[model samples]
Target chain A: MKKISKASLSKSFWRWWYGNLTCFTHEHMQTFGYMWSMLPIIQELYPTKEEQAEKLRTYYPFFNTEPQIGCIVVGITAGLEEARANGAEGIDDEMINGIRAGLMGPLAGIGDSLIVGTYIPVLLGIALGLSEGGSVLGPIFYIIVWNITSIWFQKFIYDKGYELGGNAVEMIVGEQAMAFRESIIVLGRIIVGAMAGSWVSINTSVILTYGLDPETGDKIPVFLQEKLDGAFPGVLTMVFVLLCWWLMSKKKVSPVKVMLLMVILAFVGVLIGFFDPGLSY
Target chain B: MSISWLQAGLLGFMSVLAASTPAALGTTVGNYTLNRPLVASLFVGLILGDVPGAITIAIPMQIIYIALVTPGGTVAADLRAVSYIGIPLAYVTCVSQGLDLAGAEAQGIAGALGALVGTVGTVMFYGTAMMNLFWQHYGWARLDKGDFNVLTKVEVFLPIVTHIVISFIPVTILVYYGAGAVENFKSALPMEAWYMKALFTLGSLLPAVGIAILLKSVINKTTDLIYFVGGFALAKSLGLSLLAATAIGGMFAFVNFQIAMASYKGASSGADDEEDI
Candidate 1:
């Protein structure tokens, strides 16, 4: 009987890393990719083509997860395959699939929030700032920062899952996950708020002309933007962003609808001489 | 300058690669950078021989989709098409019209076209998703035949081939003809008219929508309001740049995390003491 060696485990790891995304479909999601990744392990362990085909059949069930952080599932399953190859009792296909089904959802949430919700925005915010001056450093900085973190974290979790096996899932689903999630969510909120203040550009040059000065025979110009800024700098930008947020979150307005409303508002505002693109600071 | 046959073909091929990045190939670059309009625009600009012009068009377009997230394989607007197709079309239009890259008029064109192409991208995204179903069936058929060896083909090559065909055709046709079509449409229409000004106004306001989306995703609780407001006020009141504001925000987040950790530790320890007793 062939044993599942470190070489074969690494092969499976590379397969999952590369093939996880390739077979994405509306139906079955990442099932095909999962099966493909299991090929090396199944081929080495089962020996007979028929046994291998039977084992591969179990991977066809719907399986999807956040691929980057989801490497743990693959690593855990590799351990399971190793056990089954050694004729360990009670290590059946159902146990493997059940573990996969249970862990995918929670891991997906953690991965998505951490990587998508927090990391990308924070990095991109910095990159956008760097590139505002048209420096090539922005993209380069973003690429290096994102990849180094992603690759390092992915490998660490993958190896942990292998060492701890199926039981390691408790670490992801327990109180620790909630704390990490809440902290990232809070950080994301603050960063986005700062982004809104700095990035949501709304400036106006709408000066109200009323009443002539008796001494100078000159029209008195009262700048509305000045009063708004005096009340609060970037007040208009905040108001506009909040209005957009309200329209999207509370009002249940679709994004496309919100987009249309903004366009219409712009048109009307410009037509009425309230907003001039040229005057936007 | 008119886009030559060679440039158009090369760009079309590049578009396929761009569309395929997030899923089919180059997942690292695709998800990390190329999926962004700003980065994709730079590549398109470089390929088309106009880097600065492309970046100028890409910044506003980037803001429009800044908070874009494709949670659970569901996408509201597809940025791949927007990045590769929309930005290029906007750049081509600006050049043909002699509009200054930094001018409001050019920005207006980019935004309007970006929105239009972004919506079209939704269709393309669905099209690829739908096409992916065929290869899945092929995989099942291979499994039935007990052909585990060719599973790699079903997983990798099939999707790649399908995506290339779907992306290449539309991208080439659009860029090759879309440029002249926009130029003609621009010449015929009075872009200096009031309505066009309205469109430009709308373009300037689109970032608000993007920011709102960001806020909606990040704000999960009412108490989270302090951080949000504090961050905004920090930048607004002190005139800090985004990088500085992000640093300050990072400090706040770190403090918040420590507090959360402490409270969690206290609660868990209290529970442990009770159990011991």
Candidate 2:
């Protein structure tokens, strides 16, 4: 009974960790990186050069996902490769490829929403606050905190995938995991809203009319921003964010096009005295 | 505020390591870490000898790209260009224009510059990915001959060449020369210029698009927007800090999780009881 050495497993993990998207191409995506990662495992199991090459070719199929969380898929395949080398029943190229294909889509959704959409923004929101007045504490906090947690989480899932093998899919997609994911998404949405309120600043320069100062006989102009804020704080900003969301989600506008549209809006608003930054040399 | 060639070269190297598709230092350390505007601000600050100034400039850019998620490798904006090329140029512009880094005007300029550079970075992202096809094809040919060593070469080393061509040179040129061009432009057009007003106005409005892109990602149903509006009210109306809002949001999430799990248990137990009968 041949087994993959501990040295080879560690090498495989690190290889995948660093090389997942290194040689990425539009055609093959993560195919080369996946193959490179499996090299150590195939080499250890097959022994002969030609046999190793043949085994390595199994991962040559296209593979791409959120690379950090996609570490688990590599770990599962490593376990499958070990099992196939030991002549396990019903474990073939088709079965392994099937598992890989099946996991990529769901995992991408989870990774994108949880890690990218929610977690990073929350961390950045706090960091942006800390960065008040250009403090180094913010970036330093994010870099240290993000790297440690991300690497730890990736490594944790990788080990779990290896230990449980095919059963790992149940752990990720099970009812308990679904509850956990939903709650996290809830948290994500709330933080996104707070981020909108805190960061995005959209104001109107349009004034309804000018009020004269009766006591000093001076022209006292009433500011539109103050009036709007008195009615609802940052209502204009919220409206603009909602408008952008509506245009993108409902009207199917690309972000770049929407940005160009904002340019036009700003230009027209400026021309009509509806928007002004009030800058001078 | 002008970038020296050496500093530009360093920034260029960072961009090589930070490219999205073919990040030389890998995704975690490269794309997610160095490519982020907040993190890149620290490095740019260190390199340019202006920590406070750089961080101040990067704040608005960071907010604009706070939720830049690249699902299926399609990106709205590339952070390498935003962080490296855009920040440096914006820094020079702010310094030349004598705008306070903390003011809305500076922040607006930074946002506008970052968005413009981000598009350019997207083109370079595709270029780097396409060029790496040559090395991948070569590796495939060698692997057909049962050469295992070629995998390491193609995966790790050959991509560096692609980065040098696609990411490194362009960033170096842009940052190094863009500083002088910005100064010239600042001299030509005062802040009172019509185009400048439009530019800053555009800057203040652009982050809405970033926030909207983020909303599109997390808001699956119409009801999800209620949670968003709730958070907005918490921050805007109540004047709560982000940490305070997060604490409140976390409590809601916990309650939601408890309800979900309790229902899950109830459904399973009901099924079990029916089976027993």
Candidate 3:
């Protein structure tokens, strides 16, 4: 066999072994290929192919190529530290792919729930403003909030995962995700409850309007507000929570049916004036 | 013969459609499943001229997907949003829907329709593609060896072909229908004479239900529940903004994570020690 030069070996390796020749389905080419492709690029910069490859292996699942973010950059930092300690040998491509593959899924799940799920909704809703001024800030607010939160988490998690690779999940699950979930669920429960309360309070108030007092035309103090308060503070919200519980938990209603029913209801409500936030038909 | 750019492009997108269907998940037919929306958007962007539009569409599509949990033979979250929003948005924004078709309401409508059928088409195409198992078995029988590459080729062909074909039908039908139905809805008069306030009041409850669904996964323990109540109470008394409350809650979660992780680790290690002994 011909001896492979470092420069020529790199080129030949990429073209021959890595020509995007997806061993897996080409559909996942973007994901899988992206993680593997970084090896030659990194190796070219440093002679430590085996070393860098080992670092990158812990995060393969994050190998999305569309906008091209998230790879073994952090892991390489970890592996480099390993090399420095040992006066070490290099890393390989396979090990990098392995590391990347492992961390990407769980991190994506956490990131998806936090940044995309809870934060975006609450932030966007608040940003929508209290009036009809058509503020352009709504979209802008969400965009900025989302990007900042996402970027911070992505970078933070990658480093956190790599630096503590042996105990990354434990560190994350304990220090971050657990806390993240705690905050999320707690606030989520309350907002959900308040929304429910607001729904009922806004909807079912019994009016006790009496004609202005006969002589002075002054409204007499009646216990109407008190009566309404005593009767029901959060009837609709209660009904809503129970309904969701019943559908999703007890009766085990399917989500699709619920979505379909809600969609139909929303359209009907829009037509009938039942859904407006400030006013009603 | 070398494949021309347009032809190659057309083939690429068509392959995406075939591969992206839900039914494709079960079949060894095609490998077009790249987390649907992002992949679809990329396809449309490259085909047309607006990668930004596709990305914009992908965000909501992702949110909508959060509610989509398919456990044990079920469907959740309509994966059709890409076609519904992406296609129309692409056409409206001209993801090669044609410059002459610029702002063509029909193109927008078509894209929406394409998304709808494209989604369904993904299912049907993959279901048919499942026949590939038999094809593979037959090839193995004949040659004593088989190529997994057949699945790859079929996968590539399906989505790209499906997208192109499905897209045209919707665009055509939407154009044929004109905006007559939507126009009629727009012109239809509201019943201005009724108890409008009451009706609107009831409508406000809609969001509460959505929130309930979203909040389902948030509460794990009783302590978290207490914090939620505390945050809400603070918001009410001190008039703290909801955003402020959420941030506060997040801080509580951080503390909770530390406690929970330590406890879990201690328990696990104890169990391991017990096993060892």
Candidate 4:
């Protein structure tokens, strides 16, 4: 029985962790990184240089995904490669590639939505609160907490993947996992909304009418912002956010274009007295 | 408020590590951690000799890029540029113009500058990725001949050269010289100028796009807007903080999880009973 050593597994994991996207390209994506990571495993399993190179070539196919959560795929392949070396039946290049291709798409979606979309935002939201007055606590808190949790989660999933092999797919895409993912997304939506309210501020500078004071001969302008706030607080901000969402999501306009449109809108709004920052120095 | 060459060099080196798509320090430590505007604010503050001022300027920039999910490796705004180049430029602009770092005007200017540099950074991001093709191709040729050791060289060391050419030099030059340009621009255009007013107005309005980009990722269905609107109402109407809103949102998520799991169990058990029969 040819068993893969713990040292080789650790080496493979570290290689994947650090080099997964280091040499990323549009054409090859993570293929090179994948090969670099698998080299340790191949070398341990096959003593000869030719045999090791042949085994390493199994990862030459183009690969890319949300690399953080994509660690599981690498772990699964490591286990599969070990099995192949051990003369296990039905373990071939086709089977290994099949597993990799199948897992990348779903894992990408989960990683992008859960880890990047939801989790990081929540951490950042809390950090933003702590950073209220430019205190270093916010960044320091985020740095320590994020790095610790991220590395821990990546390592945990990686180990689980190696232990369970192909069965690891069920843990991620299973119905129960889907439920968990949906619930987390619910939390993400709510948090994003709160982030919008707490951070985004869009006020109108348009004045409705100027009232003349009889004694003092001063003009007291009736501001549009106050009137809008009386009806619905931050209505203008919500409108703009939704407008940008509609333009991007529905109309399929890119974010950069939306930003440019905002610039134009700002210019027009400033010209028409609809928006002003009231700045003087 | 001007950035010294030494400070600019440090910022340049950090940018190379923090570049998205192919960060030298890897993704977790480099891109996700250091590239974040809030985190970068601390380092920029240290470099610029004003921690509070840098963080103050970074707040709006952070909001504008709160959830920069580079799905499929396509980035809307590169944070390396936003955090490093944008924050420094915004800081200099604020200080030179005598604007309060914490004020709306300053925040607006920072947002505008961040968005501008972030867009430019996208080009730099693509440039680094393209340059890496040379190294990857070289690795591929060597692999064809069974030269396995070349993998390490291609993956690690060669990419550093790409970073130096694409990321390091441009960032250092832009930041070093951009400070003086900001000072000149401040004197030329007074705060009340129409263009300046428009620029700040644009700044205040840009975060909506960031939030919208975030909303695009979560809102797969129209009904998801309810949760978003509810969260917004909780914060805007009730004046709740982000943590308070998160606490409330957590309750909803828990309830949702329970209901989903219960339904799934019921369906599965029903299937099992039918099979037994």
Candidate 5:
């Protein structure tokens, strides 16, 4: 191969248009299945050349490859396949790693959410419901979702990864990506807020102090309750929110660790009468 | 081992995720790619004799996949845990048992652990795989960086074998046994198992917190809160189904996209005005 000068190397890989995303998916979803998810490139990898080119040029100045890490793997995978088919030479680690850098992000989104976000929850839900586990469906739902998505996407994406990758960027901002991005961003906000609201509305009980009807002989922690009432009106959920915020901001704990800690806390609370159902700990 | 079919499936998916890093070095050319939630779900179905459930979860996942990405050295999705942990959960909830994964309790612990494991596992796997690739590509390996030559062959091939096996074995076994362990655990529980059930029930609540955490960095503004709250409130006050919630969320996401795109265009226009100036 002739040595191409770094300067001559175009930031925009205009050639990536013809490549197939399935190639990356097959190797990634079928074989290995690790870091990257489909989020980075799913919407990004379009059906046409112009779209692919448009994606590239957008990220061209920043040196950000369109497919990011996961899709980059798609590129390098195609490169290796090309080399192998030609019988000229084999692939190398650097280029492969380069692909890794690009594809990891795309893969991570799907990976984290599906496995962590959706699958793990499904699995744990089963485990939580049943003693050792729930019914057989617990594991089954999770297993099926993961494999089907992984395999299907890989096969589907690879066949068109490069073809899609090659020039979608040139297509510029289109209706599809625009619509998609808008939806996700909005959905993300709503989901986050609702979840946050749940956190603020779980268990809210205030201890009574001085303010109350003397004849009724009922004391009210009206102050605290009043304060909470302005918000979600639940003490437990509020505490959960505070705890999450604190751990996340002040303690600098990882969310996973926090989750684990919460489980432990819940377990201990269950035994210690802290998670009392009537009172809503 | 004689693991049950579903357990075996979970194990299989887990193994796939665990092993992806090392395996990808040789197989996928060191991209360390993973998107395993569907894999585990499918394997569980195969084990339990039900592919339909797998398809259901996988398809939704695919459509929503527009949100995924893995950008340069950073993890976009974190598949390792998703597959190892996520698929098994689906199998447990969807196949063997009849609980919906959306609101299952056990998923809380299982989900967090699965994700945590995948992320951490990827870190170590990447480090090891990267180092091995380095040694093979350089050092005594005498591998040529020159792309497609003779000496580079041996150096290139050796690390992948080791890589693939390293990742594949442990996770597979973990997933394999994990599901069965949960099953066996249910049979042995006393009346107290109900309490365990309650705790697990609480586990369902964990995901919302997780959602909060997941969106923490992703959502950093009040308007974002409005968008989220709008959809969330619709579902909650109206008691809408998750599917409906997802739909509303999708619509809001579309609005968000429009606003963001407009801003991006504004920035571009500003650039043009600067050029004119």
Candidate 6:
């Protein structure tokens, strides 16, 4: 019984890193990359060509997960393959593939919330500040910080997954992971809200003139935006965002339709002398 | 001064290369960040010898798509084409029109142009993803033959080549021809036209769509909507920066998380065999 070498582990890790580079479609998502990543392990564990081919075929199922955090699944499978090669009992193809398939959902949920929802927004917030002043560090900071953190964290989870094997799934879906995911989800929601307020620009500049000024005998051009802001700043932006959300989420209207709706609204608003580009807050 | 035909062609070629880099490099050398309009503008600036101006133009566009996150293969917009193909064309149009690089008008023009380019990019994105399906079929055919050695090509090289082929023509033609077309259209068409004014007006509002798409993805719970409205109130009332608001939100989430965790522990007993492991 031969154990997998360090060199083969590195090759597998590299293959896993490029998992979503190609052939990603609605059908069999990440299947080809999963199969590719396991090639080195399959080759090392099974000496015979028939055995290698059979083992490799097991990874061809519809395997999709957040590729960065999903490396844990790949790493755990590597450990299981090593164990099975040493003639371990109770580990079959279904068990291995089942674990892979199972972990995909939870890990994807956590990874998407943490990485996409929280981290990227926070980083972009910082980057936007830096870039507004015409600083080159904006892009540079984003590249360096994002790559280093993601790469280091991914490697840590991959090694941990290998060590834990089947038990990793239990640990992942356990109380601690749930707490962590929920906390981040809360944080992410807050940040996204903050972002929406700051970033989503919508304002109206239409002025209502009813009465004349007593002193100057002039028409008092009452700006509607000032009154709206007096009530709640970014009120129009919030309303627009909610409208778009309702259109997409509740009404099942496509994003294209929503976008077209905005365009038409903008056209009518501008033609009626209500909304202007300079009116954005 | 407007760019020459040769410069436009060269920039077009570079744009395609830059646009495909994120997919081609595949996270090895920080290509994900390079996929951004800010970075794309940097490279375009370097090539065009106008770094500051390009970066200035790209900053606002970058802000519009700052929250973009494409999870589960569902993309809202493709910023790659906007960055590589659109920014360069916008810059060229600015130069041709003698627009001030520092002015709001310049930024608005570039942003509006980017929004238009990004709409087209959604098509290119689906087209590329759809084309890759053919390659997946090719891999399945090879896999069925029991030849596992070709899997490397299926993962890396084939996809890179497929992306380059799919992205090159549109990027080249759009950047090269689109720049001149914009200039021609601008000279003939009056900016005071109601439709033209409306188009710029619409561009200013397009960022709302980007933000809304993000909100749709992240807002799952009913109670979670409070944090969103709360954050908005905080920003509007206090004039808070995003970082400051996020920090305050983080503190609230920590307390909320502790309570939730405690309840979760109380609800489930230790002897329960729910984990199936």
Q: Estimate TM-scores for all models.
A: 0.89, 0.95, 0.49, 0.95, 0.50, 0.92
Q: Which of 3 and 5 is ahead in DockQ?
A: 5
lDDT score at residue B104, model 5, on the 0-100 scale: 30
| Per-residue lDDT over B1-277 for candidate 3, one digit per residue giving the tens place of the 0 to 100 score | 1223453344333343323322222111122123334334444445545444544433333223322222221334334434333343434433222233323232223332332333453353334334333433342243223232333343333333334444334433442232223333212412232333223332333334344455444554435445434544545444566566666756665666667766756767745432100
Could you tell me how far off, in angstroms, the CA of residue A211 lies in candidate 1 after the best superposition? Answer: 5.8
Could you tell me how far off, in angstroms, the CA of residue B257 lies in candidate 6 after the best superposition? 2.0
Encode model 6's per-residue lDDT on A1-281: one tens digit a residue. 77888888878887778655455666777788788888998998898999998888778788887788888999899888888888889888999988987889887776666776578768877876777656677777877788788888878887778778887886788776777667877777777778878777777879866578999898778888888888988888888877887788778787778778978998899889887765120
> DockQ, in order, for the candidates?
0.49, 0.64, 0.13, 0.65, 0.17, 0.53
Best by lDDT: 4
Worst 10 residues of 6 chain A by lDDT: A272-281
Q: What is the interface RMSD of each candidate, in Å?
A: 3.5, 2.5, 10.1, 2.4, 9.7, 3.1
Tens digit per residue, CA lDDT, model 5, B120-167: 455544544454544333422221222212222323344444444544
Give the per-residue lDDT digits (tens) of candidate 1, residues B56-113. 7887788777776566676667777788778888898888878887787777788877
**Which ranges of candidate 6 are over 4 A from the true structure?**
A210-214, A278-281, B4-22, B27-31, B268-277
User: Which portions of model 4 show Cα errors greater than 4 Å?
Assistant: A210-219, B270-277
The better-scoring model by DockQ among 3 and 4 is 4
Question: What's the distance in Å from true for residue B27, model 6?
Answer: 4.9
Off by over 4 Å in 1: A1-3, A87-92, A203-216, A220-224, A251-257, A260-281, B20-22, B184-186, B270-277
DockQ, model 2, C-alpha based: 0.64
Ranking by DockQ: 4, 2, 6, 1, 5, 3
Candidate 3 lDDT for residue B38: 36
iRMSD value for model 1: 3.5
Q: What is the lDDT of candidate 4?
A: 0.88
lDDT of 2 by residue, A192-262 (tens): 88888888888887777888888988887788999999998898998999999999888988887888899
Candidate 2, which CAPRI tier? medium
